[model samples]
Target: MNWPPVPQVDLLEGLHLRYGVLATELRLLSDGLDEAARTFRVGVGNGPDLALRLAAGDPRPVTYFVLLHLRDRGVDAVVAPLPTMTGEAFVRVDGLTWSLYPFFDGADGWTHGMDVQAWHNLGSALRAVHDVPPADAVVPREAFDVTRYDGLTAWNAASR
Candidate 1:
């Protein structure tokens, strides 16, 4: 991503305190780095590594609200971040927002070739995203709801 560099300390602290993930190693997934954000492949000791994205934004709740809305509608197209311990989907540390997601190891679309079916699947996913209704009128009560572990549950229920 075409974004400025962020401190590793800020990233680690946010992940640890917000998501309770104690990462042992933080490696840059250089392939996906763009101007909007910096992507990191976080290694949490013996557990499966997670994906971390550090984007320059001032804590936007609407972003996560829309993401949860789409996922609850059966659109399995987007990668929604795991919410924080306080149920916030995005955490701010040092003027940058960080979010964590379960990492799925796969080929980089830029380098890896795609088959016809893969292309069709991509189109279907995009269509699913487009079909979701807007959430401009809702109060987003679930966006800030607190949960100890299953943070997104409240958001899912609120959307329904």
Candidate 2:
């Protein structure tokens, strides 16, 4: 996969100054223009792993709010955004938006096989997230129309 340009040392230093994230090492986790972000696994000495994301065009404030809400709801599965030294959820460094999160180690179900218990755990997490009360006007909701897939609809009709 095509990865975004790696962050330079100066930018990392800026992150250190702003967020206190001292990156001893960095490993690219994923990149996508659709997501408008590039993620990295930041290694810190004697500290838990951190996920640092550099986003060009994302509604980060809203996203950060939602993550914080989930965390407040006691949903431990979600990776909540870490606050900067100035108590900001995210900061801009070198013209790119940066956010930090606690990294959780887990295999991708798409690449690595998941057992029945794993699936159950995933379902439980999803249920927990759904049980949380919405932020109402704070977060906007998007409607998904499955009927938009004409080919799939026709196939389902024929199969029935």
Candidate 3:
């Protein structure tokens, strides 16, 4: 809660004005000091629930584009962020990046118990994501040099 703090009513109102979503309830779904993002289950009146996330210092715009691409590529497992009235993927509110996604029911593979079909579906999804051409600017590239990793350097020195 301390990381980004709970969103105020005005913020939600702004969300509605910008995205045309009428958020009726905002229930916190993630709670921890170490969490990277504060997630909430948003209840929309007369519509499917949406998941709201507030994260700081994340490259959300690129991520949103990639997710949108993945969904377009027939990856049903991934949920694309809802675009604003201006067609922007994410909005900045009080120094935190806020994005909304269609909340899908069902737990992750770990919790829901992945069967054979589930594994196959997961593999297909991974293939679809990985198959995205690198030419696309939205695809994230390696941000750091692996040779500079302290743990890897230590392991290499110990092995020598």
Candidate 4:
């Protein structure tokens, strides 16, 4: 799938510098990845900058939960501007990236208001996903767990 062009990493690096993760600094990382491989495979339209900022300097549990939960549910389908996660790193999607999804013919955006069946299906999906037992997962906490109001926080190399 061909994705639209993305902005430079420096544009997001400023934002990432405010947070902790480099999902914001997509340009440089994106420079190496094939746009075709990174689409939908990368950050779905949730805007990696926002997700990264929200996840930055938080507890290991939150980070683990958010990332794991998103992965468990296949966030690629939900987030519009999919951000690609190549191992631990995340880069923005580009035209070169591609993923073969089961073709669903339709326009984008919500087509219906809340329906009983839709709610039920959403609930069912969430329940099933949550039921997946957490295995022996290790989320080592970083040293600067606390994030201040202004944005800058200690990114201790201690936490991995």
Candidate 5:
């Protein structure tokens, strides 16, 4: 019996990192990383790192970039500081980047009304994530070996 199986990922060539990158980028941007510095392979996640996977390589570095963006922001809302790269980021441990934050107790999983408090919270989080500012950090595009992070797709299992 196989103790561990190969990763289940995008079959279409050049699309493997699409979803993960996009999702990670959104989460980072949403957490406020508009001009944040990015570092690939900063650490690992529950599964294979995204950037590396997309490059048809190893640990995706871009995922760590997103995590680093979030972590640099000073908001520990999600996970603790992502596992360091040991070389660049410096990690004495081996694990995921973000410290898995506890599940938020939303009013409902199916749906939530646009109440005043909800609106306030939404605005607050949005503001926090979207409020961009000037910074010395810059991630050269040439550094990332994959396409820029973008797009979101609804998953469908039937095709598989």
Candidate 6:
């Protein structure tokens, strides 16, 4: 897929300074058209193929907290963004949020298969994520509490 061009120098420098991994090569793994974020496979100096994503939005602290909590709970399936040197999950560069992910090249897209098992597996994964209770003090209860506006519905009904 044709990904929107990455801000190469800015992103590379951010990753380098934060992670201490000087990546000599960067390749576009996928475009944001399907995932809403561009994924990049970075070839660091004799290390694993690290994955990084550039997302066009503010870094959601609560979401990252939940991810870390899930990881702590032994749900290895949940791909949490790796924290930077100062422990921030995302780095803001050129108005975009760049976050690091462990490269899982085996991940298949939602459209990969059109079968019952695939659909069931997708549903099960979603259910697993929904079922995980937010960790205490990881993401505050206030972050989950939402008051409805004129037309916007707060999705965190269970948290209330």
Global lDDT scores for all candidate models: 0.80, 0.79, 0.77, 0.37, 0.33, 0.75
Tens digit per residue, CA lDDT, model 3, 1-160: 4575554696579768878887888888743353667777888888899887778775556768888877777777788988888898888877778888888766776556888998998898788778766436775577787656769878999999
Better of 5 and 6 by TM-score: 6
Greater-TM-score candidate between 1 and 5: 1
- The sequence of per-residue lDDT tens digits that candidate 5 reaches over residues 77-152 is 4232323223233211123222222223235422545768777866776676555442335344346644433322
- In model 1, the worst 10-residue window by lDDT is 137-146
- For all predicted structures, in order, the TM-scores are 0.71, 0.74, 0.74, 0.31, 0.31, 0.68
lDDT of 2 by residue, 85-118 (tens): 9998888765578888888887777778899999
lDDT of 6 by residue, 1-160 (tens): 3435666886688788987768888888743464557878988878888988887656777877888888777776689988888888777876667788888776466546557877787787777777788777675555554444523544456457
Tell me which residue pairs clash in candidate 2. none
Higher-lDDT candidate of 3 and 6: 3
Candidate 5 pairs with clashing backbones: 40-61, 41-61, 49-60, 51-60, 52-60, 79-99, 80-99, 82-97
Give me candidate 6's TM-score against the actual structure: 0.68
Residues 27-129 of candidate 4: C-alpha lDDT, one tens digit per residue? 1222223333332222324442232211112123443445545556555433322233343323322212121222233332254466687678778767765
User: lDDT of model 1 at residue 65?
Assistant: 74
Where does candidate 6 stray beyond 4 Å? 1-7, 31-36, 107-109, 114-131, 138-160
Minimal lDDT window, size 10, model 2: 1-10
The Cα error of candidate 4 at residue 72, in Å, is: 5.2
Query: How would you encode candidate 1's per-residue C-alpha lDDT over 1-160 as one tens digit per residue?
Result: 3557667886787788889999888988876545667789999989998998887766667777778777778888787888889987787776678888888898855688898888998999999988887666434445764566586787789899
Give the poorly placed runs of model 3, Cα more than 4 Å off: 31-34, 58-60, 139-160
